[model samples]
Target chain A: MNVLEIRGLSVDYLSAGGTVHAVDDVSLDLRRGEILGLAGESGSGKSTLAHAIGRLLRPPAMITAGSVVYHRKDEQVDVLKLAPKALRAFRWKELAVVFQSAMNSLNPVMAVGAQIDDVLRIHEPDMSRKARGERVVELLRRVGISADRRKSYPHELSGGMRQRAAIAIALALNPEVIVMDEPTTALDVVVQRDILHEIRTLKDEYGFAVIFITHDLSLLMEISDRIAIMYAGRVVETGTAKELHRSPRHPYTLGLLRSFPKLRGPREDLLGIPGTPPDLRDLPPGCAFHPRCQSAFDDCGRVSPRLLPGPHGEVACLLNENTGVEVQA
Target chain B: MRFLARRLGFYLLTAWAAVTLNFLIPRMMPGDPVDLLVARLKGNVDPAAIEAMKQAFGISDANLWVQYVDYLGNLFNGELGRSITFFPTEVTTIITGALPWTVGLVGVATLISYLLGTLLGVLAAWKRGSWLDGVLPVSTFMHAVPYFWVALALVFVFGVTLRWFPVSRAYGLDVVPAWDGPFVSSVLYHAALPAITIVIASMADRILGMRNVMVTTLGEDYVVMAEAKGLTSRRVMWAYAARNAILPNITSFALSLGFVVGGSVLTEIVFSYPGIGSMLLKAVENEDFPLMQGIFLVISLAVLVANFLADLAYVVLDPRTRQEA
Candidate 1:
């Protein structure tokens, strides 16, 4: 069953210059208990799409057109259509998110347990303080931090521990979907590996869908069940992680994969994408990626390709058609 | 606790610097205070009487180091000496008598203003780009307007034009000193104009300040995290945004507490309310060196002590600062 469905979602940021089409004509679905990696470069509107899922974007950024229908338990509610009161209840109990800079996300002044209890106090105020304390301890233990650390402040914990604490807070309500935006970006490689492992174990144990958004394609490939490649505010490709690794169809996707320094490979220089993603405010016409695409034909500059199915994965590249100029690299 | 001790030590050093400057600045001035006072009292006093007065005022032929040591010694024992203007009244006595009036008047006013300002700020931030945003520019302009000017305007409108309350003084002469309803009411009635002036004067800046802080904190990723966690907007505002935003204001408020002893000189002068500001002004005009030095010492100490408490409060309010220290 589809846990979350985003249909033709478009987000526009109303800046001083003009309306910036941050997320343009994006649509995707997350199945129950599946980890979907939403991969993109810095200006690709990946985080904007994630924020839109929860109706979290504020002006001058707005959801211009979209329907984010989120399914919690059995019933479904269009997140945008929900009234203020309904929306309040809908968060945490149904969906939770671990934001970027998870360490700073925790209040510096408040103790860890009190902060967690505050979550319960807001969402489930009827729970007695003692009961909440017990639950917090259990939650802390599950996240591999000492229960006593609950009395400590956010500053008291290391970066990795803080991330775990944030994850624990996200899971406190046991929501069906947990959206993580670069959760391990600040941690060391070993710590990042540990956090990813913990996340995999937690997802398996809790049985929740994950919309993991990150710029690290290799990290996404390791854990995601399926991957969606976003460029210039649109999803260019979507496939099983294994299929994306073995064979990438889109030019942008192939370039992104090749850019990463592979641990298993012989010593070789990394190939970074030649230019930055197109500016959303003054985006180029036709295919947004065409300017950056190496195998661009005349048609590629004139016609924008929608995400279409090809041999290995869904591809948005015009070159993937019967012309057969294999860019397997 | 060690951090608190460290802060206390730092404050003491600051106070020592302040007191040192206090002792030095008076001596640095061109005219001798004793000679000036003698010149003023030529008709009523003899040369021997002038010498005796100077001796009482600690202007004997002692070394600068000895005088400094005596000044420090006198401060510890609460021996602020007598005021020249308010003859034979010790500086300590005047300050103590005036302290309660300022506390009851400005302290309560400040409390009321802070609460009202913070609430308005929160609401204005939450309801951004509405009529409330229009209120911000106006309040910010009001905040920029000087405190004395605001007090004068309030007096003009409420006292001169309307004649609703007393123009000056804490209580009416007919009210008597019974602490009864009439006395209480009269004091409040007279206080109302100044209180309102002070509140209106401080509220705007605090509102704008808190609004800016709230807006910034509300945009923080944690606030979004809190919102995503099913917390209501009110919860997110108060629990997450307001809690963090109020830290700077809290420190500012703590520092303001020290100023309570000095009183707003212009506000007191306008109303002729016999507070520390009025007393300090007279001392400055008369060049009563000891009185001036004493008042400065008190003000600096109050500021230091309040700041110390503020540092302690940071630990209580923000656990992260506690860990870091």
Candidate 2:
């Protein structure tokens, strides 16, 4: 069952220059109890999509179109249409978000324990202060942080610890879905590995879906149950992690795979994607990735390729156009 | 503890420099207090009596070093010499008599303005493009207008035209200085126009400053994080954003509090209130060296103390500062 169904979502930023279509008609699904990794380069609008789904985008960046339907056991909620009060209640209780930079995200003036307890205080008003304090301790301990570190401020904690605290806060209400936008981007490799491991363990224990957004395809392959690759504000391909790793149908996905260095493989020159992403304000004609795609054909520059079902999963490239599958434009 | 000790040592050094400057400034001025005193008497007193009067007032033909030593000694011994404007009255007594009025009127007004202005600022920034944001510019313009001008305008409208409040003085002359209701009410009634002027004039800067700071603070990741945590908009504004945005405003508040001892000079003059600002003006006009020095010393000390208190508040409020300490 899909926990979140995002359809034809579009977000535009009204800048001084013009209205930049930051997140052009994009669509994807986050399944129940699954880690759906959203992999994309900078300016691809992955973060914007994540924020749009959460209804967290500020003005100047508005949802131009589409619906975000949050599916629970007995009801379906169109998240974008929720009133301010209802939105407040819907967030954290149903969907919590962990931001990119943990150090910057946690309030420097507040203690970690108090920050986590604040969530409990708001959602569970009946809980006693003593009980809240104990829950905070348990939450901290669950995140592999010592109970005593609860009193420490964000600046007092190491980067990894702060990230863990952020995750702890996300888990405070035991929300069904947690959206993490590059939660480990700012941490060192070892710390990143540890945090990712902790997240996997916690997710298994809590049985919650996660939309993990990052630009690192390698990292996504390690943890995500399913991986979705986004390009120029649209998802170009999505498949089971193992299938996507073994045989990526989209040329852009293949380019992304080639860009990263492998730990153990035959010695070969690393080739990064040659050209930068198309400007959202003035994208090139036809397929947005055609300019940067290495294996572009005649139709690739004239006709935009729609997402079509491929043997692996779904691919949005002209290479799979005539594969006798239903196309979704 | 060491950080506190270092801060204390720094304040003490500043106090010494301030006191030294205070002692030197009046002496450097062209005229002498003794001459001013003697001229006021219109040469009616004998020359010998003049010398004796000068001696009594702690002015002598002794070396400059000797006078400096005596000044420092007198300062340490709590003797601020005599006030030439109000002869036979000690400088300390004159200052003490007016301190409460300035502290009560200006201090209360400043605090009220800060509280009210900050609250308005937070709301305005949180709801930018709203009606409150529209009024912010007018408040900023009001702040930019001189306090004395505001005081005078308030006096003209409320005191003169409306006949609602007294234009001049801290209290009605008919009321005795007592803790009784009538006396207190009279003081408050007289102080209303001046207090309102100060609040109106000072509020704009606080509001504008807080609004700008809040706009930036609201952009901070922690505030966004707070919002993402599903906290109410109120909690995001007050607990997350305002708590941090208010730090810079706190420093400004302390500086304003420090100036409260010196009082709003022009505002006091416009209102003719018996506060330290009016007293300082009189001291300068009469060249009352001891009184001028005393007022300067008190103002400097108040500033230093307020600054130290602000630092202490920073330590308490910001964990980052505590870690650095």
Candidate 3:
């Protein structure tokens, strides 16, 4: 069942010069208890989309036209239309965001427990202070921190500990959806694996859909139920994580998977997608990805491929026409 | 605490150096201050009376080192010595009499100005491209206009033309010298022009300083975290951004406090206010060595102590400072 559905969303950033179409027309969904990994390079607007769903997008980054409908209890509610008080009430209780650079996200002055307690106080104002503290301690323990360390300031914790504290804060309200934006980007490989394991365990125990945005496709393959590849503010491809891993259709997706340095394989030199992404403001012709696509043609330059039905998945590529089976669906 | 003790020791040593310089600079001048005073007084001063006055003033030197030692010894005992210009009055009494006026006037005004400027600066930063940005340029213009010039203009408009407040002096001559409501009100009323002039001149730089800091701080990943957590704009503004932005402003406020005794010479002169600045001016005009030395010592000491307190305040203001500590 779809837990979060984003439709016809386009976010424009207002600057001194003019509006920057940061996120062009895009739509996607997150299934209940499923991890939807949205993969993209920097400036691909994946972060903007993630921020938009959480209603965390600040001024100058206007959500021009779209609906971010969150499904809870079989009822669809547009998040953008919520009043300030209603939005805040919904935010921590029903939706939480584990932002990028999670290590630095914890308040330096406040203790980990107090920060978690703050979320509880804001969201569950009815909870007694003592009860809130107990819950926070329990949350911290679940996230793998010693209960006593809850009183310690954020600086007392290591980078991994801080990330854990941030995650714990997000989990404080037991929200239906948790938006993890590069949550493990700042952690070491071993810690990243450990945190991801903890998250998987937490998801199993508590059950919240996650919209995970990251650059690491390999990492996404390990955890995400499905994956979406974004380029120049649009989803180029998306499918079940297993299907996308085995038979990726979009060249950019294939290129990205090939680019990952495999440790055990008899590897040819890792193939990197040549040329930088086209400037979003000055996108070349029709396809933003055409300049980087090795299999570009006149038609590729004239038309932007939608993420249409393909074999076992959705893929946006001009080459899909020649590959008839994937296109027929 | 040990580190703090070491810092305190170093500050005290530097302040001692200042006090020593305070004593020496005046005495080292080309002519004897006593001789100059006597010459100015011309035959009204007897040779015997002059000698007696010199001895009493601590200028009848046994030796340079001996005099220096005595000077330091006297300073330890709170003997700033009497001001020759304001004859028969101790320097300590004069400073005590003048300090409350300067502190009451400039201190309150500076506090209000700094707080107002910092708050406005934070507001401007939060709404970066709005009309609030326009405020800084006007404030900067006011700041750029010399303190004396602003003072003169205020005195001209408010003092000479409007007659809203007294043109000069802190209190009316008819009022008995007590900290009563009318006296206090009169002092505040008369001080309004100079206080405002100082506020206008200094507040812009403070606003600009805080605005720059706030703008930089707003970009920190933690602020993004706060925003992502759905904190209200005001909470994010005050609790997060303003808390960090106000640290530098607090230090600036402390420095302004340190210089409170020095007063703004131009503003003091413009209003003929009986603050230290005007007193120092008169001392300079008369070459009152002891008075100059005493005032300079007090000003320097105030500055050093204020800076020390500012450094201590850093731990409270910025968590980073405490975490590192």
Candidate 4:
């Protein structure tokens, strides 16, 4: 069962310089209680796509065209069409987001516990003060923070603990879908692995689906059931972790795979992608990755390939047109 | 608690330095108050009369150190000495008479300005790019305008032309001075114009300070996190954005509180309001050493106390400060 469906979503940032197509037309789905990893470089619009799902993007960054349909047991909600008041209620109770740099995302002036309780106080008002207090303690405890640290401010907590606090706040209402955008990007490797392990534990306990976005493909491969690679604001390829590891058809995905060094295997030189991404405001005609692709040929510069799905999963490249068997764009 | 003690210790040292400067400044000035008084008489004055007057003024030739010790001792005993401007009337008595007027007028006006401006600022940032943002340019202009000009403009339009409010003094001369309702009402009636001028001239600072910070804070990751938590707009706006935005404003408020105690000299002088500002002017003109020292001492001490209070407030409002000790 699908928990969320994003169809033909596009996001643009309007500035005096020009309108930046931050998130070009994209589509994907979040299955019930599954981890969906979105891998991309900084400007690939993965974060923008995540924010658009929750309708959390600020002004100047508008959704030019899209439909974010959130599926509940009884009905489907068109998130972009919800009114302002309904939108407020729909956010945390229906969908929660662990924003990038979650460590610095807790209010500095407020106690971490109060921040978590605030979500409950608003969405679950029928709960008593004592009940809410107990819930906050439990939330903190689940995140491995002691009850006494509840009164401590964000500055007093270590970076790892703050990130956990942010995640705990997102899980306060236990919504069906949680969007975590680079949730561990700010922490060191040691703490990052520890938190990632805890997240897996918590995910099993809560049974909530996650849309995790990150630029580190290696990290995503470790936890994601399926991985989607984005480039120039478009998803270039997507497949099961095992399928992508076995054979990456998209040249961009091939380069991304080789960008990271392998510790377990014999030493090999990291082959990073050749050039930077094209500017969103002025993308060249044809395949956006043609200029950087090592296998670019005459047709690669003349045709813009669409993401085609087949038995091998999805790949958006002109070279894969003749790969055969039931391919659909 | 240890942080508070450190903070308090800093204030105490500041007070001592302020009092010392207050004592040294007038003594360093060109002529003694006694000479100025005798010069005003414009006749052959008896040397005995001058000597007697010098003794009464707390001036002595027993060496500068001896006089310094005497001044410190007298300050402890609450013996600020008699004012040359109103000789035989205690300097302490003259100051006490003016403190209430200044406190009432400037303090209340600053309060009204800060509250009204800060509230509008938060609203403007919350509904950013809305009509409420119209306040930004207006506040910028008001903040740039000469403060006294705003006062005079109000005086001309409202007091002189429309004849709406009383233009001068703290209260009407016809009213008997007392704690009765009528007298209190009369005081308020006359204070209206001056208070309005203060608000108009000064409210812009509070508005811009708050609005700009609020706009910056609204961009913070935490505010966005709060919204994503599905908290109401009100909860996210106040507790997350405004609460943090208000920290910078608190320090500004405390410093402005010091300004209230220091008294607005132009506001006092323009309306002939009898506050410390006017008294300080008189003391300087007459070289009333005791009165000058007394006013200086009050202004500096008030500033130190106000800053101390701001520091104390930070410890409560921000855990970062409390972590210092």
Q: Predict model 4's lDDT versus the native.
A: 0.88
Candidate 4, after superposition: displacement of residue B122 in Å? 1.0
List the lowest-lDDT window of 10 residues for candidate 2 chain B: B316-325
Q: What interface RMSD do all candidates show, one decimal each? A: 1.2, 0.8, 2.0, 1.0
DockQ of each: 0.77, 0.77, 0.53, 0.79
Please give the TM-score that candidate 3 achieves against the real structure: 0.94
Q: Which candidate is the best by DockQ?
A: 4
Candidate 3 structure quality by residue, lDDT tens digits, A1-329 = 88888998999888876667888888888889998999988889999998888787877899999898988796778998998887877786788888777556776666778878767766677999889988988998999999999888877888888888888988888889999999999889999989999999999999998989898887898899999999888888999999988788777887888778755557757787899876776777767888887767788889877778765667778777654433211
The DockQ assigned to candidate 1 is 0.77
Question: How would you encode candidate 4's per-residue C-alpha lDDT over A127-236 as one tens digit per residue?
Answer: 99999999999999998999999998888988899999988888899888889999999999999999899888898999989999998887888888899999999999
Give per-residue lDDT, candidate 4, residue B256. 91
Q: Which residue pairs overlap in candidate 3's backbone?
A: none
Best by lDDT: 2
After superposition, candidate 1 runs with Cα above 4 Å error: A265-269, A321-325, B28-33
lDDT of 4 at A66: 82
Model 2 clash pairs?
none
Candidate 1 docks at the CAPRI level of medium
- Every candidate's TM-score, chain A alone: 0.96, 0.96, 0.95, 0.96
DockQ of 4: 0.79
lDDT per model vs. reference = 0.85, 0.89, 0.82, 0.88
The DockQ-based CAPRI class assigned to model 4 is: medium
Determine which window of 10 residues in candidate 1 chain A has minimal summed lDDT: A320-329
